[model samples]
Target: MPAVAPTLPDDLREDPRYYLRHFQFVLDWVAAHHDSLLAESEWKFIVGFGELPEVSQALLVRMVSRKGELFRLSRLDYAEIGDSDRALVPLVEAGMVIRDPLIGLDELFAQLRVPELRQCFAERLAAHGIAKSATRQRLLDVIQEYEEAGDAEPQRRRLSHWWTETTDQLVQLTVMPVCDRLRLMFFGNLHQTWSDFVLAELGLVRYQQVDLGELSHAFQCRGDVDLYLALHDLRGRLDEGESIEALLTEIPPPAQDNPWLAERRARLLYRLGQQAQRDGDIPLALHCYGLAGPGEARIRRLRLLERQGEYAEAHRLALEAQASPCGEAEQQGLERLLPRLARKLELPRPELPPTRQPRARVLELPADHLVICGSVELAVRDAISHSDRPAWYVENGLITGLFGLLCWEVVFAPLPGAFFHPFQHGPADLRRDDFVARRRRLFDTALARLDDGSYRDVILDHRQRCAGLANPFVHWELLEPELLSLALDCIPAMDLRCMFQRLLLDPAVNRSGLPDLVQFLPGERPSYRLIEVKAPGDRLQDNQRRWLDWLGRHHISVEVWHVEWRHD
Candidate 1:
């Protein structure tokens, strides 16, 4: 007979449909009774863990207690763990043994410390045609074979599933709740955001310590937690309308000694300096940044120095920083700062073109160009469909539709490491280089198609595919083969290619702001006009201006049709 599962308390048990909710319940119980459940020694170990040396902490976090009461670790994983056997002594003395049986990967590898045994395992793994790249799988396969050869040890059964089971299944057999164990297992670890959530859930760390930003790792030192908390206190005081002078007297600067803390120290000081500068205390702002070491802090200091009329110091600093090995963005910041500093220092600046006055160009509506004046976008689209010239009225679909047809593979499969992240699941960084790199292959395909005269076929295929797909950018009925063929023949290949390249360079800005409507003329030679309709009070946005500028530069025929309401 199958054994019955043990019953849990009503508070602990959850409905079958909401089984995953039980993890939250189990976490709540462990948190409530943590002090009572663990012995005094274990409690001390958990709370005082951060005080240990960073290397020791790194080792413990990499280890996970297996279902068989043994901790699983791999020699290959040690480089990232950043520790040696000496680091394990303290945990071992505390009765937290990291071990497995003879057939286990860690234990077997330990015994394999004997030269002969190492050669035997390597030979066996290799005899099975396993390359060095498949080392982990090879080890597991050899271990299984050894187990089957009459090694009747009871703990051997757990070894079979140890290397292959899910984390949740492995944690289910452990004494502690998965969440509590995970917190202890990953405390103060960098590179993964899950550890941040675990610490935050236990209330041991604040959310701001692990806040997502342009930089990958947020917390770099033990003192970072303290700095985050202190900043919170100062912000609270400021929100209550406290004076900057009064708050400055109340909070002391953070005293962090670890060299790893340099970046965090610099960032926090820069932020405080910004706050002080806004409060009209320029000296205090400079002082805060002075204590923080260089990197980005120097840039902030340069800006503040310029504001204080210290042109000589700012110019000298900018020149010094420009000579250093800096990232693309920091170099660009220094470039922009140097020009402003030059003008302030009474130095000659580069001569620029004559400033052209920006004006709204009025155009007489052509008989072929159709305008539908509706209070809303949807109403305008509906009205245009009923006109003489066949028109597909849209907000920002035309250019993107053209792009999707030209580069279908890239539109679907974004480049690895550029957009899709295994952990974060959000687009990692949409910077220009990353955006261009991810779509380079697609751009090449577009170029090849243009050269081979096969672009018409590609456009036709994409139009068909876009019609079947429920994509927002593509309206199938509007992108009929006849319409796409006309566009292919009428638009110059080089002009279209340049425009698309500009669009890919800054996708977030250029993807939108396309002309609102694409209307095709009723001629055998496929002629078309793009009209951007604006209601009376509506002006063009910056992105719209950029699109119009690119069109004007290429001498493409585009019109801005401004519409006004007429009352009887």
Candidate 2:
């Protein structure tokens, strides 16, 4: 089913308390649908929140919607909720927020301006013989230096204790952690937030209204939710430059039953391996790569072993990988590595299949032509384009856009765990291995339009109706009507079906590395050719080479244009 268009009640815009209502709607939706996922404390929070006054509720929502937990009472001015102090009373009493909470010196520095910091730490600064006019960082450094020299423990105190003369009060929201869990349950991920609702409501963004059935939820059980959160936290720690060894110990073992969680685990381990390599810990890197489940991990291990002169092990792994490659990239890597590894081990050279080379041409243009056109690709495009054929520097956008349009329904199908909320730009399992397998029937039905000569109509209709909606594959700005119409006319449906099939083989990898420009010739029996432009001294990237080879094998017209600048 197509997503329902976004509609709002007539009075929704007029109401000043619309955000409060939106927040309430999310809570109610989660409670009604995902009540089993909520914990005892979370259930109590929902019940207690409803009992609070409207002002307190509105104030709390406003705080929750913002970035951080701590907010200065004076700065939180809202016309919808009058007198924040009065509203805060109910929140503080309900234990949703903490008034005058103990905070560390680092946090105190973050909250205060230079002037405020100087005033607050005047005694400490003067005792250390520091100047009042010093920069905030300088003051902080001096104070920290003196404190460290004296071996003083870090200080934690209330706002009043830190700044005796200041009248402004600070309150820390205690409910954001629980609210985040609720948000995760509603969105199925932490990336989307409350702003998605606000954006959709204000007409700033639109979404497909997927028909989420009774069984439509992100988590099958509480354990899945807990595991997802734990993985997310570990990823955060890795990003924050945490100790690799410590973080490795904390990461949960791969979830064998759940490919989604397993993929996440593999990605984290892969990233950890990369970090270990950067740190120059070869042994640790090898261990991480060995344990990093599937995907690029095997290739990394092969490369590391090769680099360390462990040719025997590298050759063995290469042969193993050649037998069962993860994807095209990994397969390509093995093709190159195996030949070299065999030579290193003094073994008989393995006979590999001959490589296909795409048609290549060299163009000599005036050096200043680059200055006029701004890039080599554009210059090449302008030079080759004529009345019979025109080229656009589309790179990966055109073909992917066509795929997105043709498969819109299949992509947005509300499968179990595919979509948990209205704001998702695409399905949750879009890049997973089973993405196509799980929705094979829907995909087959949609692709059937191509065979019946209805794909052009279907794609054109979607372009007209769903122009501005977000899609992972489609680039709305690049898919102008003229270009789209031209592509539909010039590119054969059979060719499109072939390209779409390759894309489905590996959506995450194959979506990239398309030729830089696509030149279309429109007429009776219209045709198009894909072109990859390279400047002086530039070479084809691994992904680009793979794409060129694949396209040529499928009998799709593709070329490499190498541009040279004229010395004169």
Candidate 3:
């Protein structure tokens, strides 16, 4: 008798409709990218990798990382992604990190007793010309001891020595008002906390001994534009009820006839409109949203109209927002998002409580953390200012978000698009060399458009305009070119709720086989991929048996992954 085919693999066992060898596909994906990856470019590189097909994304992680690491990705990591849904639990449980799960900087130092980690700091300091002082060693020891046992002695010693040290006690300030260009320059990308002391004394900003969060918040509350993470506190205050209008009032708009500046003015008008909307002023909210986008503005007005049971206009604009674009994925996403919104309009809305904002709280921030944020902001800014290529800033938060932007900017200089100048295109265009430099070029352009009174897509495009959220993975930069978000032709309007269909796949393909747990992908196809997302612990839902079941039914394949298992 002819030799029977070897029993299909366990995962492929009981295959009814389809068959695909995922293991082999993963092997080829990783070998291609891992060896070529550069450390400095790691972040962008990682995000770019996501552009691969789903099977390829899943397969690449498994092939590039050890089996054990791949297993952990299935279970423990990528638990708190803010947007995209699919959970990566199984992979994490299979492979775990040896190190303690990530905690804050202080908690990390206070918890782990890895002598190797201490040695690493010692070695890094020596290499970077940061001498290992006896005081430094003492501090390290105290912190390390506290890690093993939360003895107050360690913290007390840390505090006493920190206060006595004169190392980070000086600061200096130089300001350049961004009249025409909104150019915010930090004298240096990296400043020690000591430098801040001098600035504080010079009255540039108030200094506080409290955590950086409070100090930053206080700065924002004070109405000073600080491009550092510390400004978050100020943001919170502003979010609550702080006012910075007085400070802004001092700097009058330039008399020059620049369209960009006009756009900026329009943005303020839109903001006021939002305030009115929150105040339950339906007509006013519609006006602001309209300034945001005529169609967009009308749509918002329609929401209010719909809420008041004005179905006629509400129904009309819902169709308008979903209007088809020649070839724009964003428009399509909006179009797809439209029906859900329309359905919502048909439903009754409840009376929402009045928005209550607080005054910006005042707090003293430690000098060290401020220095970190300043360094990152300055580096990226300087890089863009210095580069000949069209450069721009890409950031998430307005002021407090400067730190991360700075880090990425230092590595990626000259921001893209030579200064958000009267450009005709979006920042996703990476053909230019200064692609990374404009880490925030997207937002800057939006601001420019708003200032110019031509901000058509501002409200709907906030996510892309913000550019903050998209920078999480290294590979996303590379992935941008292939994203369905930008191209309408590449995506299909499928509710992400029931199933995730690959745009590349045609649903009408012949369905010949019976249903079994294992779905067959075209065996000859090389579409395997992997996605390694780093997120908080809650990213994966504990009740995911249903999703897994749904996923198990789909013919196209994927592996949602957690990154913890790889690096550690």
Q: Report RMSD (Å) for each prediction in the order shown.
A: 23.6, 3.0, 28.2
- Per-residue lDDT tens digits for candidate 3, residues 158-219, read 21132332221111111111110011111111122223323433444431121111111111
Candidate 2 — which pairs collide?
3-209
The TM-score between candidate 2 and the true structure equals 0.94
Better candidate by lDDT, 1 or 2: 2
Ranking by lDDT: 2, 1, 3
Query: Which digits, one per residue and each the tens of the lDDT, describe model 2 over residues 364-432?
Result: 999999999999999988988987898888999999999999999999888887887778888888878
Order by TM-score, highest first: 2, 1, 3
Query: In model 2, which runs have C-alpha deviations exceeding 4 angstroms?
Result: 1-12, 126-133, 367-374, 566-568
For residues 428-519, write the lDDT of model 1, one tens digit per residue.
33433355565677668776777677876887776664455533335555665655665676666765677676777665556788788767
Best by TM-score: 2
Q: Whose lDDT is greatest here?
A: 2
Instruction: Give RMSD (Å) of candidate 2 vs. truth.
Output: 3.0
Cα lDDT, model 2, residue 70: 90
Which 10 consecutive positions of candidate 3 have the poorest summed lDDT? 172-181
Which ranges in model 1 have alpha carbons more than 4 Å from their true place?
Answer: 1-349, 353-386, 390-392, 411-416, 419-432, 438-442, 459-494, 532-539, 561-568
